[model samples]
Target: MVFKDKGRVMDGFYVTGHPSVPVYVLKSGVIFDGGFTALARHYERDIRDILGNTSPEYIFITHSHFDHVGSISYFKSVWPDIKVFGSVNAKKILSRNGAIELIQRLNNISRAHLLSYGVNDLYEGEFEPFLPDEVVEDGSVIRVKDGLEIHSRYTPGHTRDFMSYWIPEKRILIASEAAGCDDGSGYIISEFLVDYDEYINGIKRFMEMDVEVLCVGHRYVITGDDVRSYLLSSLQHAKDFVEMVINILNEENGDIDKTVNRVKAYEWDPRPFPKQPEMAYLLNTQARVKLIASKYMKN
Candidate 1:
């Protein structure tokens, strides 16, 4: 089953924020990702209402992307003692001035975009930069409480700092972008921006896990038999998408710009509302095309 609404996925897991940029909160006081600042602000009341007296203790960052970490500073302001966790590379990325500025800019764009779509109840707070309280390497286990333990798995490629959290006892995997995103269009958009091979490997690793519930980075929370089905299909889609990009690059005479434009027109341009912003989409598509070109194109 795929859940696209903002509500409780089960007893303790709740999905808040716009479907375009959803945030996951666990009753164990752990958040999967921060999501966009504006959307986070819009859903603050809902998230707080869901949490009630359970103050969030930790935030597990999947990556250092603008959308992913946009609300960390806001979250910190709410829960001053909440410790943020991310990969070592994410810590570095979030600390850089240029990256922070870019994140703020993208967040503003998202804010305007949401307002244009009639979502005007967003809080007026700005995006703030923050560093992770602790960096978790691959295989690191975070003991959230007596029965819940979150195992961090380093799953890169969408970004070098990407990390996915796994809860063995609950059979849940908070795989933000590591398993790609299902835009509810019956397609898994392959987001291997940094390294295609690493992305593919990450999906394969996820396929080997015992997951009953799969929470992706955006749009959908999959459960039951669909978890493995989604993993298998995501792996296949990544492979096929990379191969398609390679073919396009070759046909375009190994021109990265042309290939990116071509792929964007074909895959991204026709997407409906609540899709990725144009600038972010073009940037990520360029990176993916460049990676494919560098790896597969003949000299």
Candidate 2:
């Protein structure tokens, strides 16, 4: 199922995490049309619609999620000069997997785990992939024209390689998926089951920024006076959610299924559901499970 078109492209969508930042209609195209309903290349059309014949100079990805990177190759095909930047680790992942294989994996997995919330059909078939020409490591500054620098801070915990971009000049902070989400409603923030600690710290890091505008991945941009408060509330909720799950696991004597179910039972903000769970949760779960298994193996 696809997210209903709230309005035409450019209709103001409210971002949740930070209330002070206003989002422009930079792009309204969906790489994954109707949440993976079609196998065709819809993103090309989406970009054309939003850009209206103007090619974008920079495309910044939050991570290596299939949907986020879906149209990357197409963008490269159209504009040879366009530069695509993403977390350094994501670039490594792309380098190992040929673009055709990557797209094929996403296409095939499009509808595999519907029982899992936010599961959509992955892309199938072979498509060209655009390997990043440059990797932006954590703390690296991405300077756009005229001294607008987007600082790439490594905020591990989402994924080992996830980085959040900070603009000190405009005081605009683009958390990618780091700042949680706004969900275009009143205020909706995302909670991940990944490294709850890194997730928490990631949110707190934004508080230190003199950020007045916040743009998060997968939701409408948010801007307002209550940005900081709302973001903190979201962070606390994630902490509590993870802590409760850990506590329940301890009580159950390490019942993995129960732990998973308890974590799942926590109320997920509906708005972010369709676009999640983020890649961080997938990676974090694997990492934590490995850590748990290692302990038992050693014992």
Candidate 3:
């Protein structure tokens, strides 16, 4: 799908062949969120068709999660000199040998699942090594073209490395997972793997922007008058989830599994793709449960 604001043009493609992997391309040839390598390799031709020209000057990564950046190598294979941008923490995560191995493992799992769904055009190469060519901090403006500037907003809850992008001219905010995954049904599947507090704060920061178009990291994109509501509702979801987790733990007498199941009843909305895998979601829920417990239940 494509949208135009002012004179700037933006188009979205499932670069990774999964609804969860959104790669937004600007007319200036800047790509947002490269997605996983295996899926990206599978859909490289389709992605190239969308861009018309496969080469991009820069690819901005929102976070260093395996899903978000597993395909960094794909672009390098196409345009070896394309500059990659990400948060400092993301730079560190992608630099480690163990992290690369873990990312590759995650890539394989996603590939198999996608193939079962009949997406058979995936490429034959293995995921390649990557280290961000540039580490971006909050308040950085990357001038990819003469009149277009990409602004970075550091949102470090989805991961300490998350950084969402804003384009002032288009009033577009590529909110990434920081605004939570938009379930294609007006709901944000809030993810707070590291810290609930930071997640909430990040949502609030997005709310402050004059965002006319909110491009998520996944299935749906928000535009028109609905952008504000999306951000507000996403904030509420996070607050509600954290409160529910804390309350459930207290009521269950600190039984983590029970609390997870109870909270699952509320958080799990079978909307569509872009939702985390069940195993991944449960693991994240467990981490969130334990984090909140240590902070509040430890009296």
Candidate 4:
């Protein structure tokens, strides 16, 4: 069943949350970053039904993280002819046998957690290695259809391989983890797993763009005034976190655990997820503290 191409609408088609699948759909097909086939297991059919007869032409990965590229195998199985695009670093990471195995192993960890929550319609095909057809870098224009073009920009800092996309004419910017992950409501989690400077710089880079529609990496979109609101919050949060981590480290004499704990209590704008478990918050807090320490508090 093939879906007919429709005219470009202001908001073509966007979906998010529940199972946490975020994709930016265009007229040609749909564009997405990370995917968890296991999470989307129960909703894949509904997702397909929503898109009707439209087929994917490409799946542009934002980074090489296990969660980001987890469903490549499943997507490949569904759309064999779809081209995969990502940064050169992402290409190298996906090309490795070791990395592929590690991704599958991590995916299993995610799947087991999903089942605990009662989601079990997942396909058992993620333990396979899948490579991209196109290796793009900063400033690469990928033509999805006759007139639609997605310009790739290498926005490292989320991981060295992180890439974001910009559709010039539409004023839409698909910022990868370079910005921050929005937890549905309004809370944003600033996870700079690498360097704090890089993460902040990446956000600043996108801030220069005239974005009307902002697509975040996690599972949310910001439009109108919220687009600016999210970016401003992202910038301020990163700065605040870095400063707090540094001050805590200085006072605690570089005690990472103490710093992480302090950061854990820091209030996010609006608030963190209402149902966020302590363990999850602790883990992300630890990551934020560690990265901040490595980038700022180092001796």
Q: Report per-prediction Cα RMSD to one decimal.
A: 1.2, 6.8, 3.5, 5.1
Question: Per-residue lDDT of 116-145 in model 3, one digit per residue for the tens?
Answer: 667676655566778888988999998876
| Poorest lDDT segment (10 consecutive residues) of candidate 1 | 39-48
TM-score of each: 0.97, 0.68, 0.88, 0.82
Q: What is the lDDT of residue 4 in candidate 4?
A: 16
The candidate with the higher TM-score, 2 or 4, is 4
94 in model 4: Cα distance from truth in Å?
A: 1.9
Candidate 2 stretches greater than 4 Å from native: 1-43, 98-128, 182-194, 267-299
- Residues 140-212, candidate 4: write the lDDT tens digits: 9987764778889877776778888898877878885788876654556776776677788888888888888
Which parts of model 3 are misplaced by more than 4 Å?
1-18, 269-275
Best by TM-score: 1
Ranking by TM-score: 1, 3, 4, 2
**Model 2 per-residue lDDT tens digits across residues 1-299:** 11223223223222211121112223322111112212223444444555667665676666655545555665566766777777668777667656446544653454343335442342343445556667788788866654466677877655565766766766656675676655455444443434656777888888877766665655444455666776786676555545565576677677766655444444332334443443334444445544443444343
* Candidate 1 lDDT, 18-123, residue by residue in tens: 6678788888888888899987665577678887866789899999898899888888998899999999999999889999988998999988888888997776
Score each candidate by Cα lDDT: 0.87, 0.52, 0.74, 0.69
Worst 10 residues of 4 by lDDT: 1-10
